[model samples]
Target: MEFFVEQNSVVRKIWGKSDTVLFIFAGASAEFALNKAVDWLYFTGKLPSDPLGRLFSTVSYARKIVFSSKDDANKAIDTMRKIHATVEENRGAVIPDWAYRDVLFMLIHYSIASYELLEKKLSDAEKEEVYNVFYRVGRRMGLKDLPISYTEWLPVRETHLQENLQKSHYTSDLFKQYKKHLGPIRFKVLIESQKLVVPSIVKKLLYFGVFSLLTPVIPMYKISRLIKLDWVLKSILLPSDYKAQINELDVHSD
Candidate 1:
């Protein structure tokens, strides 16, 4: 059975680990708040009301594609497209093509960024491989004007960063929702983690300081992982209600 991502792929290594996946969303949550089309997310009312549940729902679809057979992955992608189409129908406005591309680009960017921050830097070929997997998913969803190669995508991603993001009222409200949901301490950790993975533009727009408090603690966290005590730390840091789902994020092994 051919998998959507090959068994030996670095993409699996990146997404398989719980810490890496958490960081991916940490960066994405910041960018999601800052996106120009964030109102589209607010339209459904699901995102702001239950942001952590939304994170798990999004991660479920992503893992389904990454770990399943090709046919299953395609079905998951089609289901996502249908879900968005239903949302568009209910809202009576077409979501912009660029909005869709911005999301796809976020997955591609954060996948590499999160892994490198927690693990080692990905080589050029490995980064291309990462881009290709998500590119196929975008093609399945009919996203347009995506760059064909990872090298070509860099400038386009930068352009999207510049043209497609702003700090709107939606941004402020979403961050408030995050803080409300995660509480003060976890919220502070989320902000510091986002600082580690997000781009310079995101840092500028979010007014994040250059230094992350988590910087010195990463080595200690890595040691915890090696000693098999990482889950204990994760449980303490994350909310109690999602403990089971957080454990499930470690579904795949390298």
Candidate 2:
């Protein structure tokens, strides 16, 4: 069977790990708080009700597209588009064009950022491959004004960071929800993890958050990995029930 994405692609290596997916959502959680369209999420009540569940649902769809045959991947993408359309119909208005682009951009940025953080930095070619996979998804979703290439996307990503985000009431409320759902400790870990992945601009804006407190742990994590004890150390940090689910995120190609 022909795959939609290559068996050994960077996209596969990145998304195949449950840890990377969590990090991706971790970075997204920071931005989602600041997004102007966030109230739309409040409309569904799903995010406030169960933020992790909503995030995992998105991760599952991403995995389905990455691991499936070409025909199945396309079908999965179509289902996502129809889901959005039905939401628009229910709301009696279209989702903003920029709002759509923001979600696409977040996926693009996090895919590259999360992988590099968990593994090693990607070469320019590998980064471009990451962009192209999600760029194809964005085009299929009919998103507008996406940059034509990864090189072009850099400044566009920066522009979106400047133009599309800000602190709002929604931001505070969402973080409170995250704290409520994750409890205070894991929520602190989430903030620290986002520090490692989010753009410098976001870090600047988050100047007084948990990142500083967690910086010392970085070298310790590296040392743990070198000694082959990182998995045990990191697993202790996560909720017990999620440990196996994370283990299952390893690469499995069609």
Candidate 3:
């Protein structure tokens, strides 16, 4: 069967690891908090109640599309579109176009950031492939004004970062929820990971010198995975309940 993303794509390799997935969500959590339209998520109350689970569900759907037949992948995309449309209808207003772009761009930027942090740098070709896969998803969802190529996407991504993010009460409350669920130490690590992946504008806005302390460990994570001691790091890093889901991230066929 034909597939939307190639079987051996870099996007598959990136999403196939649990650690990278967690980091992607960590960065997304930071941006999600800063998003002006974050209340759209709050309206459902899912993000506040169980942020990890909510993010994991998104990860799950993403993996499903990456691993499925082209037809099946399109079906999953359709399902996502219908879900968002239903939410908008129920709320009696459309989700903003820029807000939709923000979510899509977050995935694109963080996918590159998280993978490169844990793995080696991706070739420009691999980066283009990553953009292409998600660009297809954006098109299938009927999103307009998406960048025609990955090169064009860079400026648009930057523009979105500048025009779209800020610190608000939602930001504070969401971080509180992160701390409540992750405990203090892990939550700090989450924030540090956010620092590593977020755009420079966001980095300056949410400055903390403490995050630099975690920089040395990024390479160490790569080393541990190579030596099959990745579990030791995960045990120390990930919440126990989410360990299984991380393991499931490795389910893509070799």
Candidate 4:
């Protein structure tokens, strides 16, 4: 529509006149790449919850390698480590290799979309308006319940994730760290007299033909507590406040 074109043009203009150095260093689609990653992982039933901070933190993982920036690279690694731990704890369902590749593809696609937001016209508000459209793109692609992530406005390929995986100890260390945090008794069943097929009712009597009624809510509460806690903590730790990350840079890259 004409409205979109005009809006996009304005947004691109604003970005063009704003800080160029930060734009390039930040990887134009960095936000998009990371958000898409989280979205896909969540949809595939791989990740438990959606937290804006978690998405942002993961991007730092991708930015450092692609952009050749120490700050971005270190930040990205920190995010990867955090997620690796969570994945191990909740990986009750084994995800296929294709799932990881699919996540990577989402990252790449969003990265490009995000970079487009940085052209010469978008204002801070306009950038938000434009990038939100990408979330729609995810919904159309069968990810029905997508989160409203602003990754479409972020730069992409700013850091290389593949390079970070080169660290031999990264995955194991992350898993160990998160597991320790979780403690050994991550999943414990409260049972009076359990039966096969995970029976809803207990098999034995408590006080000679007497028993306490069990509520499903009790176990669901336990699971929710674990998932929600990690989601909140990760979101807080990732994406380091954007205002602090911003600094002066050259008008253009050669």
* Best-to-worst ranking by lDDT: 1, 3, 2, 4
TM-score for each candidate, following the candidate numbering: 0.98, 0.90, 0.95, 0.28
Candidate 3 segments exceeding 4 Å error: none
The local distance difference test score of each candidate is 0.93, 0.81, 0.86, 0.33
189 Cα displacement, candidate 2 (Å):
0.9
lDDT of 3 by residue, 104-188 (tens): 8888998999999877799999999999988998999889999978999999998888888888887788889989999998887
Query: How many clashing pairs per prediction, in order?
Result: 0, 0, 0, 35
Q: What is residue 240's positional error in candidate 3, in angstroms?
A: 2.1
The ten-residue window of minimal lDDT in model 1 covers 245-254
Give the clash total for candidate 2. 0
Global local distance difference test of model 3: 0.86
Candidate 1: give its CA RMSD in angstroms: 0.8
- Evaluation by lDDT, superior candidate among 1 and 2: 1
- Looking at model 1, the pairs that clash are none
lDDT tens per residue, model 4, 176-214: 432343334320111211111111111221111233232
TM-score, prediction 1:
0.98
lDDT by residue (1-254, candidate 2, tens digit) is 99888988989988876667878988988888788888877777888887777776777788888888988988998999898788889898888988888888888899998888768899999999988988888887888888989999999988889988888888888889888877788888888888888887777665635445556876687677669786886576776656666666754622
lDDT of 3 at 235: 86
For candidate 2, give the lDDT of residue 97.
86
Worst 10 residues of 2 by lDDT: 205-214
Best by lDDT: 1
| Predicted candidate 4, C-alpha RMSD | 18.7
